[model samples]
Target: METQLEDLRQQLDKQCLINQELQRQNKDLEQRLQEKEKLLQELQGQYHELDGPSQRPSNEPEFRKSRAAVISSEPIHETLDIAGTGVKKTVSETSLIVKAIQKNDFLSRLDDEQIAMMVDLLVAFDYSPKDEVIKEGVEGDSMYIVADGELSVTQAGRNLRTLNSGDVFGELAILYNCKRTATVKAMTNVRLWCMERQTYRTIITNKSKKKREQLMGFLKTSRTLKDLNDAQLSKIIDSMDEVKYQDKDVIVREGSEGNTFYIILKGEVLVTKNVNGHQKQIRRMGKGDHFGEQALIREVLRTATCTADGPVTCFSIDKEVFEETIPIEHLELFDDSKVLQETKAPEKSGPSSTLKFKDLLPVLYQEGRHQGDPVTLGVGGFGRVELMTTLVHGKYYAMKRVSKKHIVAKRQEEHMLFEKKILKSIQCDFIVRLHAAFKDTRYIYMVMEFCVGGEIWTKLKEVGRFDEPVAMFCTACVVEAYAYLHKKNIMYRDLKPENLMLDVRGYVKLVDFGFAKEMVRGEKTYSFVGTPEYMAPEIIKNQGHDFAVDFWSLGVLIFELLAGSPPFSSSEPQKIYAKILDGVFKYPPYLSEAAKSIISKLCRPRPGQRLGNTKNGIKDIRHHRWFSSMNWHKLRMCQLDAPTVRLIRKGPCYINFDRFPYDLAKAEEEFSGWDRNF
Candidate 1:
């Protein structure tokens, strides 16, 4: 049996190597194919130019025949000329956009109505020859479609190809929220159509219902997610991220640790591996094929390297969610495996503490809201949460308005800017999505996904603590949310009930990025900015703290959820901070031993000696005896309901919040230069 197992292992290894070699060969073939296509296009253009003054196709319909079918919108007369000389021709601007959208596979998959809606969202532009449309390695959204012009695609100063009329670039970046892979410069003075990332996603979800269904279909067919029902699949699809990759881009490298699983939605990928120090191509993967299963399962090195054969589109899901979607039996098998946790061991606390907020942030500031009074959802000293509506689609959103005067006065601008950046990266379902952000002269506005069930603090206080089962469900969600945050190197400084809000479905959506800090492994901060009772000893003692601080706060949060108040609480702020430092909180006689044990371990006096701060970190907490009877898989899947989630009466249940008007305590005199980019 042993010999057979060894032989099987060797066979698997050999096949993996062969698969890699095949992928390499496939990639080479793909590159060659692209070169030949480029040459062919150049020859065709030369033939047309040299063959006499035979005019190019006059109608947008001529191009649409070979590409996608154009979808017309409601009666509107917006026209654009098909002429290359920048003269007004026959076609309408909407028709030109439809012509361009049809050329891209992802956009082409949308129905006619989606195409029409996309036409409305497009913002047209004109550029001169040699104008850099999109620069390589720069982070941006806004896909550009050439309306009438030629553009050169280059990487590392080498010309890769030329894009003519109806061609699109930056689609992948906009779709995935990733960095641009190549430079696109106008070879001829041209007209183009562009759309922002949010607009594009909105068009798909709000307008193109068919495309959303198609996305669900992709998830349904996935081998790992095949067993999930349609409802579960739909939920998963909402969290899926679309990423675009250019040709020769390494999707995953063999032996490197991975956290995300990829499913090819468009184009092809080459899967390769190394054998005896020689690179080998194994196999080629095309649309609908998924790779990196081991990655989504646990902390494991990729078995094969995958590269984009040409322009590729993929849907990705990180390990945190993947673990919940699949069967528990599957996860149990990998319990003994070695998972490499990425640790960015900085020499110090990392970035400079005193960096100016104005310098650190790229403020996407906007003006003119001369419409309606801000509908206040909740309020505090220096900031307020209000409901804002977009003029274009009329969709409502929760906008967090923070006072610039207060931030500058306290010298907390760096902390504030850092918080926004952390919110923008790598979002998942449990985390509140930062949809759009804007800054003005007086305040900064963060447009975020609105949760309907009010703060957990209100719910907990109304119910006067929770049963063990109810607290367990809420705590599990926090664990998953923090897992995503900690994986991204973000430490949530505050984890009290006030920051935990419930969605309409009762799942917790972690919010308030105000005190969150980016602390990679080996890096720490000594900032003393947290609710007094929830502050970890390290922070209170002026000792540098890291992700462990959040876990410590989690302990206090759990205790509060069960006991109706925090383990260490006092009317006086100093007394509360002192009790937190002493770490001598007691549990009531009615509290279960299991619950008390978790709080004790979590709220340990020594920050490094805390339950979750150990080598295993979150893993230890998940496997603890207190949660032994818990169905963590169900909890993560949101299959289990929070026994304590309040029944919301209104659309958002803002009634549960404090009804009195909030004061502008930070209404201190605004300073110059400081509040300009605020």
Candidate 2:
């Protein structure tokens, strides 16, 4: 009995040892499984990021593609009698009108004279209680300022807000053609001051034309401005403000700190200086004469006092404006020798070398080169971009492989060819460099310099919005690129974060010239192209558009960079178009006055009146107050410090880009013979 009990104890001990070993193995397996699940989740997140709509191609035909061919026409500028019959207003009424105009952002931008003229053109109107002053969806041709009583605003049966006295409504109608966005009904008997669109435009256009003509005439005969071109003079005019002084008013006091350059527009001024404890006349200046020219170059004490001889009118620009609009080097043209040297024609040079398809075909088709399979970088509706390295040269390049069948199906052959042509012809630091173009039976390929820092849109997604300085730097880069392209008569119709790439240095490089077209000055194109949110109102209307459209897109890009979204956006393209056409948008309270001003000027509904498209051209934009601190010279040379440099250096070169899966399906069909030129 003792021997059997001992055997049972030995068996129990052996069973306990086996159970302990099994528990240890099970815990080890669980840990490994948990690790695998974590890895799987991470990979799924990466896959979804790459598969998002952000990377999807946004290019689409305009919703009105089925409409009849659009006829190209010059922008209509209607001329009205500046001295037409006007309604006289009492002193109190005039003061009220001025206050009302000043309260509105759009009207407040107008000058004192313009505001006065607008007030004179306003006609008084009375509305009964509960009467509909403006109906939603009805075409509006006039704008109104509430003089008394209250009005209600509603859209789609929802009360948007209430308009009290001095409120402005339907103001966009006076600026452009658009249907009323919301209905305005009189809650109580309302008195309003209204101005028709034609009348408003006349006051704006005729006033501007007259002022420009007067300034140009004066600037042309001024000896101090002889070295400047018409465009330069125009820019100066834009920066200057009119100042009127009564007879004998002191325009500049002797020994006072001076920083304003003045040009005489009307009347005369007497220059006097205090010499030997008595005032002595130095000179008498008339129209076309200028004073305080040295004040524009540097800070100096006034050497003389200039008093108005009679009722004097002068155009005055501060030193900041003068220096920004006209560079110091350009001002050197004032020297006679420098002017002569600059006017002399330079020796003609040979044509610049461009990438040729024939020369690149040999390198691409070398036998036994041992080139590895290309890694997919990005995938889009048209095709994909792949990372490729040449074994012979050992250089990495981005090979854009566009499927031939896809282009044919979308009828985008012309656009594709044009893009290739543009890429080959341009050589700019801010633009992606295309080294070669070649073709296969299934695809057309463009080999370009690889931008390792990847797309700006990806960075924007990581950070909700950019700080002011970073946004300014990025915008300055685009401005440089646009300046070059616009000089070549090329319009980059597509301007968005997705189309802008950053290099290893974190400098922006504009890519994908699919929608770019070289239109001659004063010419317009009818074809619709561009991302929906960035599309200009003219493009949405199917009206003729030119380089001005690019400036409109630039405004959208600026807003998106600073606000994390475009001002006009919707999931439906039609809604976006409607918003753009309405020409109404609110600025966030955080936006600086300068930022809001530039965006407003750039996104003007009238293309001719746009900041960059005006007679002053891009100078108007470069000298804008928002870029007051920007060193344009440093920005153009890529010497400005980039905000993304530290972030980029810490990660892999291509960290900002998502890895896309390679398409394993065979080409649906082979395209032959048509790509002979490539």
**Highest lDDT among the candidates is held by which one?**
2
- What is candidate 1's local distance difference test score? 0.66
**What is the lDDT for 525 in model 2?**
60
lDDT of 2 by residue, 398-436 (tens): 878888887775666777888888888777889998887
lDDT of 1 by residue, 345-420 (tens): 3322222222222322211113224222234666654488875554444454667878888677556677667767
User: RMSD in angstroms, all models?
Assistant: 29.5, 14.3
Root-mean-square deviation of Cα positions for candidate 2 versus the true structure, in angstroms: 14.3
Positional deviation of residue 369's Cα in model 1 after best superposition, in angstroms:
26
Summing lDDT over every window of 10 consecutive residues in candidate 1, give the lowest-scoring window.
60-69
